[model samples]
Target chain A: MATSRGGAIGPALVLHLAVLAIVVVSEIIGLIRVPIGIGAVILLPILYAFALGIIFNPNVLKATGRVLNHDATKLAGTMITIAIMPFIARFGTTVGPQIEKIIAAGPALILQELGNLGTILIAFPVAVFLLRMGREAIGASYSIDREPNLALIADKYGLNSPEGAGAMGVYATGTLIGTFVFALMPPLVHGLGIFDVRALAMSCGVGSGSMLAACTGGLVAAVPDQKDLILALAAASNILTYATGLYAGLFLALPLTEWLYRTCAPADRASTMH
Target chain B: MNNEIAISDAPAEGRAIDLASHAVQLLVVCAVALVGNWVATNVSPLEALPGMACLYAMTIVGLVIAKYMPFYLPSVAWISLVAIIATIPGVPGAAFVNEAVGKLNFLAMATPALAYAGLALTKNEFAIARKSGWKIVIVAICVMFGTYIGSVVIADLVLRITG
Candidate 1:
């Protein structure tokens, strides 16, 4: 039975503790010189896949259903606006010549710096407003309660489901697929030589982010109640793994992959693709 | 007295959930995207682009989960944020976001708004599922992993053949 009590620690807290423990242990292990170069790149997708698998499992969905049902249309509109905002901001800038100079001086360096700043200038407020609007819309439709509708959704998606073949199997499969696709692009790009290894890596990495976002969104919608918690966990894990993976990809994976792609990819295949 | 109590309390409860969810969702989404962006940077050579891509991808994934599965936006956002933050850092800076200010900027300024917008635009839930489904997620993951493994294997093979 649920009680009306404040500061009550529950199973979720326990789980959070366990996850924290794992993170600490992993970091310690990482410090032991595990040849992080290659391992780091490979680890990102694997870890992310696993985390998301857990978070978006069925149990989470059951919880969300009990709390609320959001308006689908408003949510969709918000996503489109958010997606387009970056491009609009970038191209829409009035400082054309100054931007060109920065771009010309060092495309990657300048863009990286600008992008970071730009994301700040434009992205945050928009998201907050959208969320606020979404909640308002949801409120109009459903009764308010402490138990979040969002959490209920997490429960229903099998995110907190018992570990089984279905959850683990699917997650593993997805991770493998993501990793493989990421692995292939560098070589193909390297063969072209039109862009540096770093440039190719950047393109591929960005592409992966875009693809992952779309793919994750689709997965969340499709699985619904079967893997809510698993999905949530996996999503959480991806954030951690991807953080390292992104760095590794930028510094290590891209160069190594490019070298490999240039040397190993069949001359004919590389040539044909280029 | 009773009527006055009822009127005042009524609106508070009604608005409370909206306020709570909105606050939590905004914080969680922004935080996750910020952390995810940091992680993606570490994994790929692309620096910020990969991080951004991963953030976008996770957002999409979270949306999918929320739309179809029974998960809430806040929980998904938090879980995603924490997980990505945990896994991506091989070298502190490599996988992690460089400069606290940068991290703060992304989390504070960019993520919430974008997430809100993304969530808003999503529609045709049934169509999205029918069109993409589990197969697409599976395929996408496979392709990602395959590319990495294939690149390495092919590279090794080419070296051997040439030698």
Candidate 2:
């Protein structure tokens, strides 16, 4: 059961426009401060992460509607996360590089496998767990059979059904894993004498874009319900994590994590759709 | 009964544009920008602060324009114009172009990787065999090895070419 299509288009257009405006304005402001630029990039995925939490959560829009209590808590948790992330990143960088040099057999092939595992273990799970806890604390709920109206919209666009949403979730998980792994590259590269901040930023952007595109595509195909909202929120978080990882991996962690997932586990991908 | 249930479940068909929502979004963007700028100042010593007055003016004007027009095209057009006017020869548009390209590149890489992963998950291929955790670990180790070797190969190629 869908409403007449007339009203939906305008609101969707407005939301899209709003997103564009935010990106444009933030990028412009970013030009003045390099850290701001880094922040802008990092913020995208963080925002996307939160949006995914909302989209997947059965009670999100309703919770978001109750701005005073539920929504406020979620927002507060997000802000707290954001506030501490930079410090965490700083610490990670300081500790990572020194450990890299000591453990590596030689300075040249300094990509430490353990570093990658640590990133996967530390970053993705922490971010996802925080998001899930925040959403739950904010009273967001989910169930196997209770599909919201937004899911219908997603279905109409040929996205994942409720049964298929897990596929996209896995993709998000993978991206997070990949991002943490790539985080070590900046330091590893620098240890080899390629320590240019701008260049590092560019490389990070490439890695982030790749992850975002992969995640977006999967979500669009399998979990289109509130894809726009999810993307917007997740993008914000992604930007922050990427920036922190960049600073941490390059400056602090020398022979950073050397993990990569070139091909997906066939069983995990297949089991995702209903 | 069915009709009523369907009708009630849906959000209002045509509630007027939520100006409040738009306003909230704008406020969030501005707040994030301000905080981000403050953080950047502490982190990057070489950065030049964009004039707050100019930034506010630009953002407000941008918001106003967005109300009546499409968001991305106009904003990009305006930002590009500002950048062009601000650019000086030999200064290089590296920052602007690099930032833009970097965003584009992230999206590009993310799509395929996510798709593959999604497909794998859906197919139930993402399993570690019993007593085979070590095998999975080995694969992960190999991935690390591959990335390092790959980077080294590329770096060597670049150095040779440059020399």
Candidate 3:
């Protein structure tokens, strides 16, 4: 059933077409245009997908399970993987011409963007002390924003490890809400007028490229004069997140999380910990 | 020998037909994407075509490179790198490429991809989180919370230095 024969399409093909139709419908309904089209907006493509998926879910495991189990979805996941860079690349070109301006503004803006790592500091303690989550969950909950984090965790703790499940949970959560939440930060900060627009713009690049773009887009619309430099700083910071985030998270962030889990986890429960 | 060989070739012949159909299916998906873009932005389909072409073409090229890479370079990085090089200001077609591709919304493409992901999700997908109980949700919230706090602190510090 997974494969097609005699020039006929299969379930996978139907699934793809059905999904695309939903996308077209969502666009027509303007679900993506919520909260104004300015700085840090919520596009909600993932939300849309989840909603439609549940609605269309046949509830029959065999037929519906086919969509979940096929090799085609894996291929589609590959398609989405390739989609990330070009998505960022589009933003990259927009900022490429403005690199010199951002450089002249101040290199310190790059450091400001490192705040993305702050998640580990806070998430680890909260997960270990407040929530009493296991060590694996601590690493996962800290930074499950990207693919490499999943790989790193899985490599150290087998895919079936508690850490893997924890990673998957957080990854799903991040995929669902991380972009929207992160997208709102710049404008909110800008509205507070607590920081210079440049710092706010630079901070927008907390490593997730799309989130960076969304944050920067909001800032650009909010303060149009700073567009080029803001975008440039964000692009630079985001690229750095991809380049350095893996090692930083694995070496620096997760270790801190692990240490917190060890220190904060109660003595009775600590002995059982990984 | 001829009848036996013909019988053996049926599945292979069917596979070839399936492959061709699969390609058509991809093309149809692309068409839906373009049409959807036009409806959402009111950008003419003609204007959006070039950008869509570049996006898919580069993805194909990126896939090819990914197939050969010795290490684990993501396909997006490769596609993005090529797109960036192509659109640099001094390049011959930079302006055209930027304008054309810029017209197509990457978010639009993401819609279908996410929707497909949704269809694949059954209630069972949440079983792990359920077993983990409320702790997973707490971790998710804490992750976002910490990231926000971190962003604010970093932004504040950077502003202080620059100002």
Candidate 4:
């Protein structure tokens, strides 16, 4: 029922500009705050867009439906693919001088970077035993979600299948809120000042380029003194996550998650019977 | 000179014109996005316009280089690698562009883009998640929680040992 209109660039641009305007106005009215500098202001736009979409849906301004559909919304996402590298590259410039710091941080930095996998470790068991999900659900829910893993799952299980639905569920959640989580969490954690800033920085590097940028941006803005080091650590850790993540997700994360699911969860027939 | 020839030629001509128009539209969109990025950052238009242009130009050049690489490398990776390499002090033109563009607030640029993503949410996607039931939310929450805890433990331990 909510399928997109596909290539309507004109309507897409108009809707995007409208949402952008709302965000700017909201920021001016002091309805929103960006203590972590200009980067953390992303939440405003999402809020604006979500609100606008809901108000303008079929229940409200029915004529505005075309502007709020999947196609119009996706235009910005496709544009994001373009913006991501430049953001990271600009971030990369700062890393040049921080090489020595990165080397000094060494293995500890790597371990902190490994924190990105914490979700997989925890989710695998929860998905299997607690949720009673099958291998497909466990695999889809366990890793850093992006296109490649989704494709792998789709290849093994048809897009219409239950596995596909599982991937879709997580993918939807990740797409919708992942950036917000990354942007807000670090600064909140850092503001409390419980952990080392470097550890916070390394923790920001959870693979996805956009999230890395968001997390690192908030961390940098929050702890401006360690800006270079934070960004450097984030950039390096992001690269490792991206480089190793696919192999790990498919071969290591998914298989292991599936194994845990089968071993721990009651059989599918049993769960259904319950 | 026949009707058939004119009809076939008209379709071919229309296709070419359509393609050229699409390309122009794309470039215009790129410019608009740059402007949006600049405005969102609260930078003065005078200072930011040229800086945004330069930054975008460099990214385009980086994309071109990535396209020509023998092996398959995503443009984002190549762009970052290229931009980083160019930022070295002695490299001509790199330092200037890096200085100007690097100052542009990344979060500001990302904001509208993400807002666009929010706007993109369709009822269909929502329906699918809903149909899958509350379990999907549970899975999503657990995944997010797991990530947070994992990061905290590893980060704290590493810092303690290293610091």
Best by TM-score: 4
DockQ-derived CAPRI band for the predicted complex in model 4 = acceptable
**What digit string (tens of lDDT, one per residue) describes model 4 on residues B132-151?**
66776667766765665577
* Segments of candidate 4 deviating more than 4 angstroms: A1-9, A12-16, A19-23, A26-61, A66-77, A106-113, A191-193, A268-274, B1-41, B159-163
- TM-score, candidate number 3: 0.76
Candidate order by decreasing lDDT:
4, 3, 1, 2
- State the lDDT of candidate 2 residue by residue for A1-274, as single tens digits: 1222222444333332333333333333322211322121122232332234334222334442332232222232222212222212111211122232222212221222113223333332232233222111100111100112223223332223322232123222332244434333333443455432212222221123333333333333222354333233223223333323333333332222111111211222222111
C-alpha local distance difference test of each model: 0.29, 0.28, 0.58, 0.58
- Going through the candidates in order, state the TM-score of chain A alone for each one: 0.26, 0.25, 0.74, 0.74
Assess candidate 4 and give its TM-score to the true structure: 0.78
Q: Point out the worst 10-residue segment of candidate 2 chain B by lDDT.
A: B1-10
How is the predicted docking of candidate 3 categorized under the CAPRI scheme? acceptable
lDDT of 2 by residue, B1-163 (tens): 0111111211221222233443443344333433343332332212312332233333334334434553222221232223223222233553443232222212221211221121112112222121113322323333332333333443334334433
lDDT of 1 by residue, A37-59 (tens): 22221222323332332332223
Chain A TM-score (model 3): 0.74
Ordering by TM-score? 4, 3, 2, 1
Residue A227, candidate 3: how far off, in angstroms? 6.3
DockQ of all models, two decimals each: 0.07, 0.06, 0.25, 0.26
- Give lDDT tens digits, candidate 3, residues B1-163: 0111101121122112233333344455566677767867888778888887776665555545644666645444555556656767787887877778778765555455455544544344444445445666667767765665576677667567665
- Mind giving the per-residue lDDT tens digits that candidate 4 earns over A1-274? 2222244667656765665564464334322546553333324333443355445543246676665554554454444455354565666665555667777877876666456667777776666667666654654576755555665565666555656667767766666566666667777776666778777777666656656756776676667787777877777666556555666676766677667666666674232201
